[model samples]
Target chain A: MEFTLISLLNGVTYGLLLFMLCGGLTLIFSMMGILNFAHASFYMLGAYLAFQLSAWLGFWPAFFLAPPLVGVAGALVERYGLRRAHRHGHVAELLFTFGLSFLAVEMVQLVWGKAVVDYRVPPSLEGTLFTLYSTSFPVYKGFMMLVSVGMLALLAALLAYTRTGLIIKAALSRPDMMQALGHDVPRIFTLVFAGGAALAGLAGVIGGNAFVTEPGMAAAVGPIVFVVVVVGGLGSLLGAFVASLLIGILQTFMVGWDYSIIDVARLFGMQLHSTSALTRLSLTQLAPIMPYLLMVAILIFRPRGLMGARS
Target chain B: MLEVNGLHAFYGKSHVLHGVTLEVGRGEIVSLLGRNGAGRSTALKAIMGLARAEGSVKFKGEEIAGMKPHQIAWRGLGYVPEDRAVFPDLTVRQNLLLGVKDPKAPGRFRLEEMFALFPRLEERALVPGGVLSGGEQQMLTLCRTMMGNPDLVLVDEPTEGLAPLTVAQVAQFLLEIQKRGVSILLVEQKLAIALDISQRLYVLGHGRVVFGGTPAALRENAAVRKEWLEV
Candidate 1:
């Protein structure tokens, strides 16, 4: 029972991290209908930026400073890259962002090298909060929770109450009306893209040290993040939140499910040798495909996604 | 004043407005009368620069043919689209906020002024525009344009799909707007409303202006109505 609780806590933490990264992607894509393939590359950039900032200015400063820096970079991309590509159509924008992601990943590798850089937890957040059934829950994980919740609140308030938020919400629902109302729709798009990039950068700052910071980390987590956005209805923040939690918990629990294919076969009165392909099929081998499977299932059942409007 | 001299507009390869020329003096309500598919809406769109247009389009002695829609709007031209393009997700207050495009010191309606003009909108400040009745949406669109405090407004089919009472209400609102020293380029299918409200009228057919004259002259010319307006 205690183990189950630990797993649940672990899942929630991980889910929140996924939410931090994916919330931006979902907003940018759903609202703007720009499939930003390089979104994960921005995540990798955030991690590296935090690492560089930490080396010079310490962990606390990196946390405070790196996200806004990343946001500026995102704004530049929106202004010069995405905005220019926008005139060519959504497909061109997608391709441009996809190329950007490739370029970002390569740039990170060139700057940081191909090795896993050691990124330690900050001294203030070091060590465990408590031990549960011989397993320790790190204080850093708690800190992560606080950050994610704070960010989620800030985002909610920004979307619900502010004038810019009101504009974004209206534009998301009725883009044509926004134009008819004499809004420079392109400027709004740039703001949203930058804001989304900043959110992804914030996730990277916190998650990089907790997870592994490496050049290839973007490729590793990219599909999973996209899966979260897809599972959450496209352009629906509520759906994204729910899907994040679901995927987070599922991925966490699947890690410890010990029953193998052979065990399942044995329960049905069958045997397989070590050399057999059936026995060779390991759980870890199937782990990466699990989210994709869920994504496909969700797509088949609800094409508009959980919170997406039919129109 | 607003003027279109040999204005040409197109949608892809198909020409939608051809050599359409007309004018509206300040404090005047001018109507564009045409049958369905006669390019009245396209002409309005061309003036607003929302549609692709060629040739001279001028407002207040300034060239506006190649300007963007927002730029044209910033220059005191308001547009009410045929479909009643209200921001469906926004509250009435928020919708009113988008209408004010100018930063000038004179000729702007404050938020409270708009509320007084459309009290229904003030009551529904927090309500979504989409849920409003058709007549309410029409009023909201017109009031939202007035919120920008534009000098000249282009209204397209404001009475379309409206009951007779609601249509009368809209007509009254347009008259009130005109009394405020603003010019209007009104597009309408209802001849009665156009003839009743407009000082001058232009008849369009097959993407061209077939006739231009006073509203009384339009009403008097049986051949013009029979050839261009009547189905």
Candidate 2:
């Protein structure tokens, strides 16, 4: 029971982190119509950048500085790379982004190399927050939760209240109409792309100390973020949030469970196990693949996803 | 005031508009009448810079042959597309707010004045644009363009797929706008409404202007109508 409860909290933390990254991807895709394949690379860059900055200025100042630097980099990529590939249609844009991810990963490897950087949390937030049945939650994670909540509140207000936010929401629904109404839509696209990168960078600042900060971090995190976006539905931020939490919790719980399909078969009194892959499966082995299974099922049953409105 | 001379537009090398020339004086209502595929809409699109074209287009005595759609819109030119482009996810009031070009400074049109003109929009002001009926959507599109306080409007097929009573309402609306000193270059199909509202008429046929005259002259010229406009 203690293991289950601790894992649930862990799952929520992981899910919120995913939401931070996933939210930006949704905004950029809906407004700009490019599935930005290099988003996690930005996250990886954020982690490295923040790690380096933290050594000089401490975590808080690095946290403040890293996202904007990443945002500027994202803007330049949009101006010089993605915008240039736009004339050839969506496929070319995707290829450009795909190429960009490789370049970002390689650049990180060149700068930081293969060793995992020791990105420790600030001593101020390094202690445990609370204890439950001999299990303890770290203050760094608690701080992460607080930041995630703050981000969600900020995002909600921006989308609902501000003029720029209103225009972005309006543009997501009708881009041509936005352009026809005298709005500089390409500029809006650049802003959105930069904003998304900034968000991923923020996530990296916190996630760097939590997870291993290395060149391979983006490759590990990128595919799962794509799953969250897909399962959440295309062009829908709310769906991404819900999907992120659900996948996060499910993956966490799956990792905790010791048995799998073979155990369930034994409960049903079925003893016919003749070297089949399904019978040999363990929940430990199944944890990583559960999100993909859910994605496939959602695609087969409801292709629009839980909260998706795209027709 | 606007003038077009020898305008030729192409949709990826398949010529859609050929040597179309027309003019509109300030506060005047000029109607471009034709059947489908006759390039009546194309003329408006080319002038709005929504289509690729090469020609001499003079507005306010300055040549504006090539400009982006947003640039034209910013320069006091308004275009209401045939599809009635409304942001469906936005509230009707929000839609109206988007039409306000200079949000910092007041313009010729006010929200209350627009509501007074169309009480139905006011009643459904908080509702999302997608839920509005076809006629309401049409009214929203027109009112939205007018919210920019444009000097000239390129209205495409204002009376298409509308009831006769609603058609009269739209015509009244256009006249009201004209009374406000806004020039109109209208693309309309129903010959009766076009004749009733327009100060001048240009009939297009096969990407060319086949006739240009007053409503009375157009009524008398049965050959032009039979060749260019009549189904």
Q: How much lDDT does each candidate structure score?
A: 0.85, 0.89
TM-score per candidate, chains pooled: 0.93, 0.96
Q: What level of docking quality does candidate 2 show?
A: medium
Model 2, which residues run further than 4 Å from truth? A266-278
Model 2's DockQ? 0.69
| Backbone clash count, each prediction separately | 0, 0
Model 2 chain B worst lDDT window (10 residues): B62-71
* Cα lDDT of model 1 by residue, B182-228, tens digit: 89999998999999999999999999999999987887899999999
lDDT of 1 by residue, A86-124 (tens): 889988988998899889978888888889987778999
Q: Candidate 1, overall lDDT?
A: 0.85
The deviation in Å at residue B26 for candidate 2 is: 0.8
At residue B17, candidate 2 shows an lDDT of 84
